[model samples]
Target: MTRARRALIDLSSTSYYHLIARCVRRAFLCGDDKYTGKNFDHRRRWLVERIKLLSSVFAIEIAAYAIMSNHYHLVVKVNRQQALKWSNNEVICRWYKLYRGTPIIDRYLRGEELIEEEQLLVTELIEKWRARLFDISWYMKNLNEFIAKRANKEDGCTGKYWEGRYKSQALLDDAALLSCMAYVDLNPIRANMANKLEDSDFTSIQERIKQLQSNNVYVKSEITHQVKQPKSLKPFGIRDHARTLPFSLLDYLKLVEWTGHHIHTEKNRHILKGTPNILKLLKIGGATWLEVIKNYSNHYGHFVGSKTVLRAHAAKNDVSWYKGVG
Candidate 1:
């Protein structure tokens, strides 16, 4: 049965989530079409650019992503606290970037006084928009809808472009987060589209590698302040006063590289390579970690975590049971 998104997503349980959306009928809509012999690789660029653009406007941060031919994966962290801290004007300014506001809002921005009722309405609208700024549903909706419209126009047809509502799974612990990120980053290699991490185009791992190699710093025209890390993707490092992934960036890169090697080897042959140190820190057996990343979708439903954490979340949500408990 299809459950309501609210029932599935509990922010108090966790802020990080793994999301997936597929092309309609599992067609090669974003890659080279084998049936028609036409290339649609440009569509992948469209999705990547839109994802980054929305991340800047919304309070969501992109932790990892991979754009495949028929589907895409995203591991994002919803920064609700950041959204709450935005002033009313700042909220409106951010909202205006994606949508046009009412005349009252324009006048308000122009320094013209609004009537008491108009001011109240403005307050109500701002509150609603503020909530949406950090909402995953709204973020994905904006992303999928924009691409659907543009792709439809180019294809000269008017119908559904996406399969359905994007699927989401809450990451209840560091184990789940780490495993899911590796799974997403290694998608191309698993699918046999790329043999190595560097060849994994349109994947966050590739982008991070390129940025590090070239010593590039992303700057946005609208952002007045400077950020030391890549602006589009979240920074990976030990958690401290500033928000970041719970692992070091170099360690993560090594982990991904190590995992990619194992993935390429024949299944029956056991390679004598040692596991990356990050796996030891996370307390995950390297063989177990490889299985989880290889079959991530089969292991979990709406929530992914240890058996204890999954049971607790299920009880809190008033459900009899949850998947991925084993």
Candidate 2:
């Protein structure tokens, strides 16, 4: 059964989430259609650029992402607090970037006084827009809808492009966040689509690697350069920074590379060698981490975290249980 979005997403529990969306019938709409022999590889760029644009407008931050042939994965951090801090005018400005406003909003923007009713309407619209600015569903809706419309127009047809509602998994803790991010970044290697992490096109890991190489710094606590990291993606911070991932970028890169190497070497065999230091700090066993990364989608339902956290989340939502409790 499909649960309500409100029930699935509890910001009080966690702000990070893993989202997946697939093409209808898994038809490779974003890649080369084997049947039609029409390459749609350029569509991947469309998705990436749209994601960057949306992240800039919304308070949500892109932690990790991978654009595959038939589907894509996104690990996002919804900064509700950031959205709350935006002034009404600021909210209106951001909303107008992606959507046209009503005449009343236009008048308000132009410094014209609105009537009592118009003022009330403007207030209501701003509130709604403010909520949506940090909303993951709205973010995905805007992204998927834009791509669907463009792709449909190109194909000269009118029908559904996405399989259905994008799947979401709430990350209840740092461990879950790290693991899910690694799973997303290693998607290409797992699918045998790419042989190396740097060669994995259309992936956050690749972008991060390129940025690090270009900057020529791996051990620095912070990259003070304006181009410290990919502007489209979230920056990494070891401390509890409000707008950054709670980990070091170097550690994350090492973890992804180590995991990818093992995953690419043998899909079924578990090698407990050359585990990264980040894993030790997180206290996740080498074999167990590999299993989770290899079969992440199968290991959880709407929520992913420690068993204790899962139970607490279920109880908080007034449910008896959630899947992946085992």
List, residue by residue over 86-182, the lDDT tens digit for candidate 1.
9999999899999989888888889898889989988899999999999999999999999999988988788899998999999999888988999
lDDT score at residue 59, model 1, on the 0-100 scale: 97
Q: Candidate 2 — which pairs collide? A: none
Off by over 4 Å in 1: 216-228
Write down the RMSD of all candidates, one decimal each. 4.5, 2.3
Candidate of highest lDDT = 2
Give the per-residue Cα lDDT of candidate 1 at 323. Answer: 90
Identify the runs in model 2 with alpha carbons over 4 angstroms from their true place: 218-227, 267-271
Q: Of the candidates shown, which would achieve the greatest TM-score relative to the real structure?
A: 2
Indicate the TM-score of model 1.
Answer: 0.94
lDDT of 2 by residue, 1-326 (tens): 98889888889889999999999944576777888888888999999999999999999899999999999999999999999999999999999999988988888889997789998999999999999999999999999999999988898888899998999999999989999999999988888889988889999989988888888865334454244888889988775676678887877787888888777777467555877778889888888898899888888999999888999988988888888787
- Displacement of residue 259 (Cα, Å) in model 2 is 0.8
